[model samples]
Target: MVDLKVKLGSLELQNPVMTASGTYGYGEEYEDFVDINRLGGIVVKGTTLHPRQGNDYPRMAETPMGMLNAVGLQNVGVDRFISEIYPRIKKYRTNILVNVSGSTVEEYVETAAKINALDHIPGIELNISCPNVKEGGMAFGTSCPSTIAVTAAVREVYNKHMMVKLSPNVTNIAEIALGVESAGADSVSLINTLLGMAIDVEQRRPVLSTITGGLSGAAVKPVALRMVWQVAQAVKIPVVGMGGISNAEDAIAFMLAGASAVQIGTANFIDPKVTEKVIAGIEDYLVRHNMTSVAELKGALQA
Candidate 1:
């Protein structure tokens, strides 16, 4: 049998297929459609220290092969998540990774501290790439220094596995990846969402309220794969690759390119059971290829 189990720092994942934050809501939302336990882990929606109403109307828009979203980090805050959501989700038989966001360094630290106290949550994914907010959302993720600062700040407070989510809007993703790794990040997940825009030529205005939103879905697969490959090669820390991943083949390609594991995002919208399908597909591929372990495929690229 193919061993799909992998480790993201101290946290162990049963498989490499997981739902990307923001795209997967709280795991519970998709429990009826798919078996949540089959996933490697769940990265819940981006949570802030305080509840946020998110952006105004028209937060989502459809593009050619992907979707644009400016949800503005709409979440029920960490307090509510821990007090309410966490208790309910603890019953599920799967690792829980909290996706965290903040407008300031202090907020990130406090949120991490609060999550650190939780007994059920295993890890935290710092979403430094949310482009919807005005202050610290994508701002910290786009630059190397800011990424290091934010990651290191959270690292100091949270002792558990810390995965930094990177933005695809930067010129050099490897630089940011290295910065986070140097700052003691356990792992890194990338290509959050490409900064993109859509225009209503007839209406002479942008379709999304923010004018520009994060682009996700099949349209971003190639770009995200390249970034993941580059960052994985540059950093020693494990890379949790994501961006437009739709099927087992896409996940396999990411693994061979150097990702320790893969996260499924936009594809979930088209099919809620996408993660389960990808997991089975990966197992079939491994069996056909006569591979005993999925980890052997990591960084198996050729020139």
Candidate 2:
């Protein structure tokens, strides 16, 4: 059997496939469709210091090849996650990661600190893409300095595997990834939905409540692949790539581009069992290529 185990900092995933935060909800939601233990990890929905009701109605819109979302990180506060949600999901055999988000650096740090105490949680995907309320609504990950500051602050309080998820809406995502790496991020996940919007010509109004929202699906794959390649080359830590991976071929391309692992986002909405199919397909490709371990696919692109 081809070895599929991969590492993200000190955490060793049985395979390199994981479910994106918002797309997969808690592990229990997909338990009937997926074998949760067979996957590498499960990143729960975005969590914050306090519960958020999220953006108003019509916050999501469909485009040509993708979807736009301004979900605004609606979630139970970290306290509820720790006391209620954690107990339900901690039983999964795979790694359980929380995608932590906040509008302020202090909020991020406090939320992450709480997750750090959970013995079952091995790490957190620090979502620096959240809008920085204190800074007039600019995303923290869009600014290199702000990214480092928040990452470093949380790194101080949380000692587990801290994977900082990067925003694709920046001019220099690689630079931001490097900043987080320097700030003590154990690894980095990239290409969080590109900023996009749609309008209703008939109604003469924006398609979504928020004029613009994050875009994800097959359309973002090319961009996500390029950014993952760039950041993987720019940083020493592991890279977790996600943005539109729908199949094993796409997942393999990210690994060859430089991602040590990949997260399936929009595709989950299409097929709840997509993650299982990808894991199987990866092993099949390894066998066909006469490869022994999936790790060999990392940065294997001839280019």
Candidate 3:
């Protein structure tokens, strides 16, 4: 049997396959379609210090090879989530991580501190992609100083494993990754989504309510892979790669590119059972390659 277990700093996962935040809802919605206990982890939808109404309607648009989304990180706030959502999902056997987001450094720290109190939540995927309202709407992950500042602030309050999610809109993603690492990130996941926009030519207008949105899916895989490779080489912390992973091959490609694990996002919308398939497929690939452990595939790229 292949050993699929992997260590993301102090957190050890059953396997390297996990459902990305915003894609998998609190591990309850997909209970019927997916075997929650089988997954390495489930990153619940984004959670904030306070409730958010999110963006206007028509926030999502389908593209050629992917989709554009401007959902605006709508969540039920951390207090309500701890009281209502946590009890239900905390019973799951696999790891459950919260995707913490905020428009300011204090908000991020407050949200993360609350999540850190949950015994079942082994870690948090700090989403620094949210626009910093105090900084003229610039995303916290885009600038090195901002990324370090927010990550360091959250790190002070959050004692558990901290996995910072990197945004792809930055000029040098590796530089940002290093910044987070220095500030005390246990691991880093990338690339969050490429900035993109869709338009309805016939209507002579943009498709999404927000003119621009984050682009994700198959089209972003190559870019994500490159960023993962670069970040993996740049930081000592394990790298959890995500963006557009649809199958075991795609997941394996990220591992070979230097990712310790991978998260499934847009593909989860298409097939709720994709995570199960990927776990099995990874084992199959290992057997075919005469390998024994999934860990062997990390950074095993020929080039």
Candidate 4:
């Protein structure tokens, strides 16, 4: 059998398949559909310094091949997450990656420090790219300075592995990637969601309550792959790529494009078992290609 284990910063994942934030909930919700331990890691929903009720109703809308979400980072506060959700998930065998968000640099530091004090949580994915909210959502991530400042502030507090999730809604993604790297991020994940909108001409209104939301699904695969490839080349730190990944082939594509690991997002909405299937598919590809280790495929792209 081929070895599928990989590393994201200093954390070791059983495989390259991890569940993205927001889509996977708190990791315990999907326990019935699939064994959570089988996954490399679980990136729980975005957690803030204070509990947020999120935006109003009709926050999600389906597009042609993708979906738009303006959920506004609805999540329990860090205190609640530790007092409630963390205890239950601590028993799981996989690495627990808390997906954290903040409206300001101070919030990110406080949240990261709190999670760092936790015994079971292994790392944190700084969600600097969420596009649905009004404050500090894509604002910090779109610019290089803000990204560096926020990441550096959090880095000083959170000693554990930290992966900075990047936004695709930028002019030069490579500059942002390098900025995070300089700020001491252990690794980076990309292409959070493309900014998009849908209009209901007949109703003379927008599909989502927020008017515009982040677009995610198979339609975004090509763009995501390109960004990941570019960021990987620009940074020495590991890159965890995600976008429209739905199958083993897609996962392999990301690995070859320079992703140290990959996360499955919208695909989970379609099939809860997608991550397991992707792991299996990767194994099959490795066996067929006579590859001994999956790590060899990292950044194997040709000129």
Clashes of each: 0, 0, 0, 0
**Any residue pairs clashing in model 2, and if so which?**
none
The alpha-carbon RMSD values of the candidates against the true structure, listed in the order shown, are 1.6, 0.7, 0.6, 1.7
Worst 10 residues of 2 by lDDT: 59-68
Model 2 C-alpha lDDT per residue in residues 130-236, reported as the tens digit of each score:
98999998999999989999999999999999999999998888899999999999999988999888989999999889898999999999999999999989999
Residue 278 CA displacement from its true place in model 1, Å: 0.4
Off by over 4 Å in 3: none
Worst 10 residues of 1 by lDDT: 129-138
* Candidate 4 lDDT tens digits, 182-294: 99999999889998999999999998888988999999999999999999999999999999999999999999999989999999999999999999999999999999888
lDDT of each: 0.90, 0.94, 0.94, 0.91
Write one digit per residue (lDDT tens) for candidate 3, span 80-173.
9999989888899998889999999999998999888899999999999999999999999889999999999999999999999999998899
Steric clash pairs (candidate 3): none
TM-score of 1: 0.97
Estimate the TM-score of every prediction: 0.97, 0.99, 0.99, 0.97
